[model samples]
Target: MSDANGGFRPRLRALDRRQGLAFMAALAERLRPNYLLYAEASEQGDPAALRVIHDLIWEALLVKEARIDFERQAEKLAEMEPPAEDESFGARRALEAVMALAACLDSLRGEAPEAALEVSELSRSGVQAFIELTEGEEDAQRLAALIRQHPLMDDEYDFQAAVLEAVEAPLDRGALKELRRLGRNGGVSNLGLTLD
Candidate 1:
């Protein structure tokens, strides 16, 4: 379907339906930024102190959808620990962290409307990449590479893919487990915000 502007809309994939929670979690991680932006230059404060207020404004106005997604992931993971094979326990925890990043993004977005607009444009474009997955491996790889190149870091897709692959086929259990854990902390898990 096309939007009012005639831009092509994305249809959610079968994979998205089967792993909606995972998709949202991945998105939240993707839209959220890494490291706080400097609030202001200050000699009174340490030359280097982590301040995320700038990033907060970027998230709220820009990555609201992804933030909402991350919040859901975090909420869902609150109760369980060490999930069973089907439960994806490790992925759940990583989703929680994605929520944290979204929270920070929301805060940043409130402060800077212009920057927020730019970020939102990037996010909408990113979703188009998600839509491209239905085409084929070439499309998927292109999207994945685009995602990897994106300023926001989140490795959930890579992690989830590895897990899914292992679940679907025979893979090294140890390697699979490691990838699952790494997915949570990996570069892709930066929670949807640009490092810059």
Candidate 2:
């Protein structure tokens, strides 16, 4: 069962896919660790309503880390006026890190054996909206494009690698160092993407 957000978030409108992914990460942090996020469309029931009692211990650990990263982002963003623009290298890495963390939530989403969010679901529901309001086609396309711009070429590297690779100039080594520390130790690393 989706929240009261009118079922799947509207997909027709062009949304910032980066923002959507970030939001997904935040939502995943709120869920029980044992509980996955997406389910196959053929699933019999609501994956969201599963029992959180099974693994509160593990969930607590993941949640603690996620909360820390989330707080760090909030603090950093707060330092800037109106959140500034989104083209900064550090800023993009920060966003990608959030997206990486959010992927953890994606793993949980398709847990339901029968009710996953595969192509069939989208084909029927316009691939734009689903029973729950999250993301859709435009976001997916944007994500693909964004993925192509990764900082590091290798798959083994993570968010830190991406950020480090992208930021060629050492103009703000100190600030980058601090951010790198945060990225490496945060809940999720944006190694998949490079510094913008």
TM-scores of all predicted structures: 0.24, 0.22
Worst 10 residues of 1 by lDDT: 38-47
Task: List where candidate 1 sits over 4 angstroms from the true fold.
Answer: 1-12, 16-18, 35-196
Report RMSD (Å) for each prediction in the order shown: 16.7, 19.0
Q: How many pairs in model 2 have backbone atoms within 3 A of each other, for residues 3 or more apart or on separate chains, i.e. clashes?
A: 26
Tell me the tens digit of each residue's lDDT in model 1 across 62-124.
333534443443233333212234233223333233333343343333332232223323344
lDDT of each: 0.33, 0.29
Q: After superposition, how far is residue 168 of candidate 2 from its true place, in Å?
A: 34
Candidate 1 shows a clash count of 24
User: Which residue segments of model 2 deviate by more than 4 Å?
Assistant: 1-84, 111-196
In model 1, what is the error at residue 21, expressed in angstroms? 2.1
Writing each residue's lDDT as its tens digit, candidate 2 over 35-126 gives 12111222222233332211221242234343233344333323321123544333332333233333433433332221112211222221
Best by TM-score: 1
**Top candidate (lDDT):** 1
